[model samples]
Target: MYCLNVLFASQLNHKSILKLIRCCLETQIPILVFESIEYETLADRNHRPSHPCFKPLLFTNRLKIAVEIANAIAYLHFRFAKPILFRIIKPWNILIDKQNIVKLFDFSLSVSIPKGETHIKDVGRGTMGFVAPEYVTTRGCFNEKCDVFCFDVLLFVLLTGQEITDYLRCEKGNKFYLVYDVKKYFVNNRVK
Candidate 1:
């Protein structure tokens, strides 16, 4: 098993971030860092989303992994005292060790809510493909549901193995329709 020789201990400031990492560590989730590469370098190459080796894993094991990611996000947003807006939720921000268990990394863009704030503003940021449409177009107020929207998009890409742009263009109307169209296409193609 790969071990993170240097833990990013300084980045673990928020309660949610600390808790999430703790749970993963306790449960023996493989989230070690490779000494040779920096997280920024991995993210720059889009290792999580577009890597050829990881692509197959997306198709074969995405559903289970998505569930785990959702649970992790849910724990941060709802279970914690102050919700954490993980502004960046792309696959690149997540790390996997030899065990294939996911560990979320890169806390550079993360934001924490105070006890009473209903929403956050002045933070216009997110990854490209994984960002929600409303957030991109309107730059309006957002909450945890915005992250959910991104999650849905990620799930679609993993299942279909098609670029998100293709799905968006080919499948029109609502987001649900788009997702349905992509899934249907994949299913039909597989059968043929």
Candidate 2:
């Protein structure tokens, strides 16, 4: 059964967003019916390509999906009266429908800050590489900004099919980290 929390169900009005067909709050479990999306998770597509000779995704399609993801994140972070933090934003967590529409799923890691609350204690519930540095350096102290950082990493991964480790290994000396690599590249036109 499709599951959608009340918080997200309210935002289903957006066109790019999925629509809720009905809600079932009767039994112990809560279930919300949404329009069925014929799709596969981006992670699955990457991990085990359905076809042996997988055709490369068009640059345009990748860009479109990236834009859709950004829009969805923007909406989630600011569109509502109360902002929502999508703690986990990664390609595997994204769904690509048959029509090539992107649907960001797996909101289990998401949290809703009370209208006036500024900083809630971080539980360090996030994936590696995609997680923000503040969540690491500060010992689980971070905010929505973490999502923005993750998005940047997501964009990089999408453009270059390279994992964070792979990118780091490509550096000559490997003294610079993932986040600093871009700046290093701009400064010396190389990763050091």
What's the TM-score of every candidate structure? Answer: 0.59, 0.76
Q: How far off is residue 155 in model 1, in Å?
A: 0.9
Write the residue-wise lDDT of candidate 2 on 111-188 in tens digits. 666778764567657776787777777787656788899888887776555555556567467543567766665698
Residue runs of model 2 more than 4 Å from their true location after superposition: 1-5, 16-20, 23-29, 46-50, 164-176, 185-192
Q: Quantify all predictions' global Cα lDDT against the true fold.
A: 0.54, 0.68
Using lDDT, give the best candidate's number: 2
Tens digit per residue, CA lDDT, model 1, 1-192: 123212333333332232223313454654533223222321322235555544335334556656767777786687567786666676566655433455555555556666888766644677556666666556656677777877776666555555565545543553534545546767888622
Q: How accurate is candidate 1 locally (lDDT)?
A: 0.54
Candidate 1, clashing residue pairs? none
User: After superposing candidate 1, which stretches have Cα over 4 Å from the reference?
Assistant: 1-55, 58-60, 165-192
Candidate 2: residue 190 lDDT (0-100): 48
